[model samples]
Target: MLLDFGCGPGRVAGHAGRALGMRIIGVDASPDMLALAREEGTPGAEYHLVADGRVGGLADACADAAMCNHVLASLPDERTVLEVFTEIHRLLRPGAPFALLTTDPACAGIEYASLRVGEPGVSYGPGEAMPVRLRRTDGTWQSVRNHAWPVETFPPLLEGVGFTDVAQHHPTPDEAVGVADPEHVRSRDWSAERLRPPLVVTTAVKR
Candidate 1:
């Protein structure tokens, strides 16, 4: 089975279970998000609540693989981020792959089609507070306060928690050609995206 660590609203869990044909165990701390996930139930997927930083009734090394999507930026500090990573580490067996998706902390000021991080020409320190703006489909923008965790910090944290071969990559717009919507890729002028990619994918193996 695969674990969708911090699977808010089941977007990643449901899509992953459907696209990859894997049995998913989605765990989250929010009751409201869990309720939404249950409402939009994915086939061959189960939802659970994370209480006191632990997913209840789950055994260690039960998941073959896991993924966390953009969950770290919401955390207050590196210690809390490590705590979450450690929990995810416990769920996977030896050599299991953990793919983490996050916003690149350095990709601030640039306005992408969907989101913008921090203010223009401003840089944030590790675990520093910043304002993030996300563009909705209706052309509306939503502002949220988020913590910035630089890309460099993840490898050490992941390694400290028994994860090896940790690697981080900033994905450019060109890389999304095949997987993402063709129309979306074709329609937008992605100069800023090509120049400063906003998304980072960190991969590691449980050791």
Candidate 2:
């Protein structure tokens, strides 16, 4: 089974289950998100609510792989990040793969069509904490605060949590850019530098 850690509204989980024909377990901290997932998920997609940094009701070593997407940067602190990592480590079978995707540290002040980079809420340096505002298709705005941890910070943490073979992957601008929608004002800009490696993806195996 595949576990989707911090799955919001079951988007990724549902897609993977339908597209790959995999059994998916989605876990998230929000009751509203879980409710939506249960209502609008794929045939083999199941959802669990996380409490106190734990995925309640799930047994240890229950999954073949786990995916965390856009979740770590939103964590309030490193302690929480480590706690989540430990929890993910606990849920995976031996040699199971753990994949993580988060904002790149290099995306601080760059401008993109869908997102506008704002001033750092905590510090002005790359790999520092900052606030970003996202523009929706309907012209609504959502603000998010994220920690831009250096790419180097991931492997050691994964290793500490009994994960091995940690490797980092960077996507090129062509692979990273989203398709532009003429109807949406916030559609992606194919020419923006922010489209270049806006995310960092890491994969490791549970030991």
- The best candidate by lDDT is 1
TM-score of 1: 0.95
Error of 2 at 112 (Å): 1.7
Alpha-carbon TM-score of each model against the true structure: 0.95, 0.84
Who wins the TM-score comparison?
Answer: 1
Clashes per candidate, residues 3 or more apart or on different chains:
0, 0
lDDT of 2 by residue, 1-207 (tens): 999999888877877776667799999999999998888847867789889889889999999999999887777666888888999999999999999987665566666666655453323343456787787868788998776676678899899989999999875455432532234424344466434656678999999
Report RMSD (Å) for each prediction in the order shown. 1.2, 3.5
Which residue pairs does candidate 2 place in steric collision?
Answer: none
| Ten-residue stretch with the least lDDT total in model 1 | 11-20
Model 2: lDDT to the true structure? 0.78
Candidate 1: tens digits of C-alpha lDDT, residues 143-196: 999999888888999999899999888889999888777998898788988888
